[model samples]
Target: MHHQEIMSESIETTLALVDAEIVCFKFVVCGTVFH
Candidate 1:
């Protein structure tokens, strides 16, 4: 139904945000270690 579609889109957006946060975290860790 339409509600389910909206739910899935929100879930996907949340997952994308988490993925970006993880990548940023890793980058910061690596930079700190190298520096």
Candidate 2:
């Protein structure tokens, strides 16, 4: 994939993980971290 695609994928994965963490009550700071 191209460089932009790779970066996009990484951002998506990070957001997914942050969402999961928020859902699981693993952390309450994903908002600032992910954004």
Overall lDDT per candidate, in order of appearance: 1.00, 0.83
Q: Per-residue lDDT tens digits of candidate 1, residues 1-35?
A: 99999999999999999999999999999999999
Model 2 residue 9 CA deviation (Å) reads 0.2
Residue-wise lDDT of candidate 2 within 1-35, one digit each (tens)?
Answer: 69999999999999999989778774546755777
Clashing pairs in 2: none
Off by over 4 Å in 2: 26-35
Q: What residue pairs clash in candidate 1, if any at all?
A: none
* Model 1 global lDDT (CA atoms, 0 to 1): 1.00
Among all candidates shown, the one with the greatest lDDT: 1
